[model samples]
Target: MTVKPADLLWPASTARLAIRPAVVEDLPRIFEYYRKPEVSEWLASHPADLDAFIERARQPELLACIYVVERGDIHIGDLYMGIRDAWAQKEVQAQAHATQAEIGYVIAPDYAGQGYANEAVAELLRICFEDLGLRRVTAECLAENVASWRVMEKAGMRRETVTRQASLHRSGRWLDGYGYAVLADEWRGSLVS
Candidate 1:
């Protein structure tokens, strides 16, 4: 058996949030965060089973890095970066390239509007394009998820389109998602003098 080092992205904010790789020890707090109705409603069709989510989120091969959003060293919410395969993501990351990594995140209702999601995403995008050598990163949010869209906007991502996709929840209904992205070349060019 072998273990690889996971990249833990750090947030850029003065608030109490400190982004780092989530550990099994953080599950209790993570559970509490996901219990928020507003935060979880748009994410899936059914309610999150806290114990199940925590157990699954801890698996290493998930290609997902769960992050703990800590404020004053207390775990507040969660931020995750799932290493999806394909520019469109269908379980084939081997088919993807440095220019087309996809990403997503969530926040507890308690932490919403406090800029935690914005800061967490900035850190992930930095790691995606810089540390991971990804050329582009995409995010998809429901058409009505204004807060999520705003987060993408604040992170410099532009919405590319809106399309219907099968919902991931009990809604059992089709949902429209707004695709957004940021390119590494563009990010680099902006930093060039």
Candidate 2:
């Protein structure tokens, strides 16, 4: 789906963390972040190779969008946004239902506890809704990981369901988890000043 101006909520604010397309120059940093225990544990990773990582990022089937989180030349973390279902975003209806583009995030352990997750996700959600014409953006996380859930809920996603033993998890066994999401309209409704 192509992004149009109407799909954007607003320009990114002064969080001072600019998120731009992941370029070849970002491979080394992204590889380092992905290799970290806190991040690698959840991801399906392979041997660390910058060339391979860059190649994978260029794959079209992935619909991957990675941004290096930077503040004053300090590379803080990486933010990834991908479209799980592009067709659904293009068919957005007024029902406030989600049928496409499941969003997820990961932050370095050292960078945790800061507001990076919130700021990064807010920007991603804005693009998904405002630019892509997406009806909703959804996310899921291990129920035991309260911080991940907090990020989703804080972004205005609802508690949709709790699936038990849905799949393998970092816990080394199947774990119950929650799914949350925010529709474009619901997100707009949430921003009452």
Candidate 3:
């Protein structure tokens, strides 16, 4: 199971959305969601301003992937995933990729409730399992965000766990969180189903 970063494709798209690598031009649109109090409240940190976002959006050397989600040329959202060591037993880790990645996404509030997140996440699962050949992909969100967890489920990821007071919200308080994930085999089986 060897995979070099060059083997993956960029700017992948679906019927209604385009999933592409982040570009400098995406700052303004990406900032649109990052700056909103409603949007930033759930995230770990909020961008102080445009310059902060610019600094944060810079692609790093070893990224699983960071994709901007667009609709008809509009930068409506972004998706991100990064590989991390698994916490399972030695035998389980040896049998799996030894590493799994977590995924997350953000959509502009104006575009919320339109099923765009669901489509983008489903496509992301394809890229993670099929293109990147990753063994597993996971995601988590503040438990209060029903929509976010629902998107993960709609994308075929099963709820793996939940932790109370595991996350610190922008509101300066601990919040419950939900973890969801899908294995490569499970995703493939879902496609057939």
Candidate 4:
């Protein structure tokens, strides 16, 4: 039920970017990005230390596929996506039935607003719906994070719902969350229409 890197293609690239697996050697760069207050503000938690970051990067592949988003050789951000129901993998494979996956992304503060997140997400969605053969891909972000939701919209996802106080922020206050999703057929339709 666990999805492994070997189960999918590696080093998929866009014209201006290269998406690759997150490796142990990437720990320091990962830590640097997550440690920044601006970068970690919307995330669930900031790494306590480099060791914690290293541990996080080492999570089981079945839980999520963590990818490094790079421009040439520079580490700019990350793309995190994981299947929602492990037991449904076989049904999905055999039936071409609907299955769900979740995606999340972050970019360096300096690189904000350059359309990179949108560009990266579009490719990730192709891999999700095409390469991974998923039925739907979803993303949730705090309602206040305009850039986050905007990226989802720019990547062809629609805002499905907003849940009140869906998450407890690092500041101790609950925040509303916006859910966005796009179906595989919808995504494919966008390509031609």
The prediction achieving the highest lDDT against the true structure is 4
The candidate 4 region of ten consecutive residues with least summed lDDT is 89-98
lDDT (0 to 1) per candidate: 0.68, 0.70, 0.81, 0.82
lDDT of 3 by residue, 127-176 (tens): 87877788889998889988899999999999999999988776678898
In model 3, what is the error at residue 97, expressed in angstroms? Answer: 6.1
**Colliding pairs, model 3:** none
lDDT of 2 by residue, 149-171 (tens): 98888888899989988868645
Using TM-score, rank the candidates from best to worst: 4, 3, 2, 1
Q: Report each candidate's C-alpha RMSD, comma-separated, in the order given.
A: 4.6, 4.3, 2.5, 3.3
Distance from true location, Cα of 86 in model 2, Å: 7.4
Clashing pairs in 2: 7-130, 7-131, 8-130, 8-131
Model 2 segments beyond 4 Å from truth? 1-13, 46-52, 60-64, 84-99
TM-score between model 3 and native: 0.87
Residue clash pairs of candidate 1: 16-71, 45-169, 45-170, 85-92, 85-93, 98-134, 98-135, 99-135, 99-136
- What is the alpha-carbon lDDT for the whole of candidate 4? 0.82
Q: In model 3, what is the error at residue 50, expressed in angstroms?
A: 1.8
lDDT per residue (tens digit) for residues 127-189 in model 4:
887777777889999999999998999889999999999799989999999999998899999
**Prediction-by-prediction clash tally:** 9, 4, 0, 0
- Measured against the true structure, the TM-scores of the candidates, in listed sequence, are 0.77, 0.78, 0.87, 0.87
